[model samples]
Structures are given as structure tokens and as C-alpha cells.
Target: MSKIKLRPKSPVRLVATLTFLLISLQIASIIGQYLAHQFSIHRAIDVVERRISLDSAFLDVGNETLNTPANRYAIERYLERLEKVLEEKNLPVVVSEIQGVRTKSDLTEFPRLHRTTFENAEQTISISINSRNPLNEVGISWLSIILALLISPLFAFTSKKRRAQSAREEIVLPPKPRLVINLQEKTISNGIDDKVVTLQNKPLCFYTALVKYCIDNPNESLPPHKDVPHELMALANKCFGRLIELGHTKRKRPDFNANLDKTLSEIRAALDDVFTGYIDEKETYYPPRAQGEGSRSKQHSYALPSIKEDDIEIIGN
Candidate 1:
């Protein structure tokens, strides 16, 4: 007769747990976003750096083929192509005439607005392309995706452990007691005879005797004693008497057998009334009263054992 105590619910614990998880997720997401942005910026810078070198090489070709109709045509074609690319990427470019010759790498920063200069005998041409905005051009949604991947497994593990704890708390079953029964003697020490009744040549009288002793001896510790109604006691007595009569009968009396069967049914129903509230499938046994039978001076106490098929004992010829 143990009881399960439920823990009190706490709003603070719930709020705290949610806050901690949200903070962890937010921190992870922020770090991922920062990395993604930097990666995109660096990638755009690399592309622009390569373009700067290519522009320098193209301008050197123009300087080599100066003052020719083919040189003018090639320069115009190169300008048209480079301008078209810059326009498509939403970048700005400027062309200017300059005095000194310069290499593209040494002219200005490659990833920013920078100038690449080419010179010949009389004139110099300088082209400066403004770097494209990395933030506007690149998508970094994979930051969010990466953060989700890292947090999913952690959330799953926490949820699983919480569910397991809840399940354990919800269905706490009591421990079972060590139970045994003796059936060698025909008479008992308390002056009650232990009758031997047989059903289909197999003895079943032990059931009645054991039940009677449990019902009559309320003060005994072997079978737990509890409160039972008069109707249940009357039914139990009738069942016990019928079993004894069936044992002593001389002929094959179907009428007696039928009466005994009916009485047994009534007895089970009575026991159900007395013990149904105390027994369950997991912990199937009668609970002992805190106080013994004699402790209740005025009230009538009776032993109500939660009976199972194996509770009945048989050990004689």
C-alpha cells in the first residue's frame, strides 16, 4: 500500500528552459551569419582582384599596338566589353587620360574603386572600376540552415529525456509481496477443520478453507484483515458450506455440483465488491490495514485477501 507523490509544476523552470534554448540557438545562428557574410565578401573581392589583373594585361596589349587602326579597334572592343560587364553587375567605371604609367596591382586597392593605367609615347589611358557591393550580390541563407542542423539533434535528445521522465512518473507501480500457502493438514490450530474437496478428482477444498480462515481470523498477519460488508460475508459462508457438502457427497450429484458452482460465482462477486478498489493487474494483492482487527473495538473487521488462482494451496493425499 504505497502511494506515488506527484511533483508540483513550476512556471519558472519552464520559462528558464525555453529562454536557455532560445539564447543558445540565437548565439549559434549569429556566428553562422557572420561567417557567411565574411565568406561572401572575400569571394567577391577575389573575383574583382582577378578582373583587375585581366584589365592590366588588356591595356598592355593596347600600349604595344599603339597608333594603328587595329589598336584603336581592339581598345574600343575591350572598353565596350568591360563597360557592359560592370553595368550588368551594377558597378561604376571611369576612363581618364593620365601622365604616368602604372601596373594594375600597384595602382590602387584591387577590390575597391581602383585605377589601372596604360601609357605609350604620347598619351596614357586609365580605367578605374568600382567594386560591386558584396551584401547585395550574395545570398547567405545557408547560415540559417547550418544553425538548424546543429540545434536539431540537441533538441531531439532533450525532448526524448523529458518524455521518458514524464512516462515514468505517470505510471509508478507498487512492489509485490512474497506469498505462499500450506495445505498438508486436515484441521487447523484455531479449531476450524480444513476440509478436502475434489472437483473432477482434483482437490479444490483448499480454496474454501483458505478463504474461510482469511475471512474469520481478522487479527492474523498471514492474510490482511480489512472492512467487509455483511452481504459479502454471507456469500463467503454459503460458498464454504457448499464446498464441504460437495466433498462429503456419496453419489454423482449434479444438483450439488451446480449449487457449488453457483455459490462460487456469488463468492467471487462478493470478493470483487470488497477488494476491487485495492487490486490492479500490475500489483495484484490485498493491502494490509494500518491497524489490526482488535484495534477497532466497535466495528466488525474481516480479512479480505485479493485472491488469484495460485493463492489456493493443495498439499495432501
Candidate 2:
């Protein structure tokens, strides 16, 4: 007889196997979305931080300190030190005339700055300030974006790992509470509180509500609704736009990953909500279902649909 061998999977192998599975199925693109999203945030932070600091310096660099040249010189000195640091790091730096006529004190601080931002594609640092005085904003742009870019991949990698683990766990789970109700199923959108239910046949009951208590009723339903895990949805939404950049299209049901994950999570949450609601109602009816105990736990209920009071009888009352 031919030997059929199944190798024991090591932790490394397990991770690798999941990675391979993801790649083979082209899930990398889905995951790559997080990287892109992180990059955007990093880039934005770099851009914004540098812009603010430089904008401030631009006001001060042309200081007309008069006899108070020391104060003016002190600020310029700070900026110069910053420039040297940037140069050492080989970050992008630019100085140009400020655009748009903006009023400011000519006393010594009206920098009125403008310049095209630049940085290495790999690093993506930009000119932090036009002047190297006061050093308030120096090199912050470079450091911010670089850190953002570096951390983005890690976040993306972590997200995929978590998703893989979650999928595996779900697979290992013994079949969940199968719905016995005739539910009115709904296709959950990517919102945080989107609700959906599926039964062997069909289920009953579908409802939509805002996901967060943080906002007014209308203010709720942020990309990551309450129906989905907040962290998961946040990470997903961060990458959501990037997935859209991956030639993803929006339909009644999104074909992309973040959207799909969000949808699935919300649907599950919705199902859980309905199931719990039903269980609460059914179980609350004392001696539930023909002098029998309730179909669910008297304490915490998981919300598996019941066959109705007249249907399946409890093994023991």
C-alpha cells in the first residue's frame, strides 16, 4: 500500500502555508491595500507637519529684529542647524517664494514661504522648511514619512496575519448556531453596522442602524461601523481607499477584500443581533416552548434560532 504522509506543520510552516495560500489566491493585492493606505497617511503626515513648521518659520526667517538681531539670529541659527541635519540624512529640501499675497508682520517673521516638496520615493521625505532657523520644523517631514512608510508594511502584514488566523479559527470552529428562523436576509454593505443573515434556507428579520454611540444617529455609520470590530474596521477602512485604487469597483456588493470583510463581519454581527433578540424574546417567555426550557441559555444567549414553541421539544424541561 502506498504511504500517505502529512507532515507536521511548524509555526513557521503554518505561517508560510497561509501566506502561500493568500498569494496563490491573489490575496496579496487585497493585503497590499494596507501598505498603500499607510503610505498615504505617512505621506500626508510628513507633508502636513513640514508644511506647518515651515509655514511658521517662513513668518519668522525674514526677522527684522532691528537692534534685537540676537533674537532674530537665534531663530535663524536654529533653522541652520536643522538644515544641516536634513542634509546629513539626504532628505529633500526646497525654498521658494511664498505664493498668494498674505499679510504678515515685517518686524522679522514674515517668511511667506513656498516650494515644491520633494523626497526619495523610497523614503518620501519632503522639504521641512525653507529656512533652517529655529529648527522647529526641521527634518520632521523626513522622519515622519519614513516612519509612516516603514510602519505601514508592518501594519499591513499584521492585518493579513490576523485575518489568516481568524479564517483558520473560523474553519476550526464546529458549525455555528444554524438559524431556524425564516429570516429576511440582507446584503450587508461595508458600513460598521451593516447587518446580514443567512440560514440553510432563508432567515427572517433584517434591520439597519447607526453603528456608534460616539456620534449622533446620523453621524454614525463611519466606514468602520459598530457591527464590525472597531480595530479591524479601522485597519480595513484605512486600506479601503487603497483597495479602491486597485481597480476595485463598487456594486451592490463590493468585490474587493476590505469591503467584503467589512460586509461579512457586519452581516455576522447583524445575524448575532437578531439571534440574540429572538432568543431574548423566546427565552423570556417562561417555561419556554410547551413546559420545556427555553431553546437558548437562560443566562448569556448566543442567539441560535429556535424551531418555535410548537416544534422541537427540549430533551429535558
Best by lDDT: 1
lDDT of 1 by residue, 1-317 (tens): 64444343355755555556556666666666667655654554455446644554445334334552225545555556654664586433322212232222221322445455544453455545444343343444455555655654443323445556799999968633222222233221111222222232112232344355555554444321233334434543454455445464344322222343333334334334433333453123233233544433344322344555444333332
Candidate 2's clash total is: 21
lDDT of 2 at 268: 57
TM-score of 2: 0.17
User: Which regions of candidate 2 deviate over 4 angstroms?
Assistant: 1-82, 89-308, 312-317
Estimate the overall C-alpha local distance difference test score of candidate 2.
0.34
Per-model TM values vs. the true structure: 0.26, 0.17
| Runs in model 1 lying further than 4 Å from the true structure | 1-9, 60-317
lDDT of each: 0.41, 0.34
Give the top-scoring candidate (TM-score): 1
- The weakest ten consecutive residues by lDDT in model 1 span 187-196
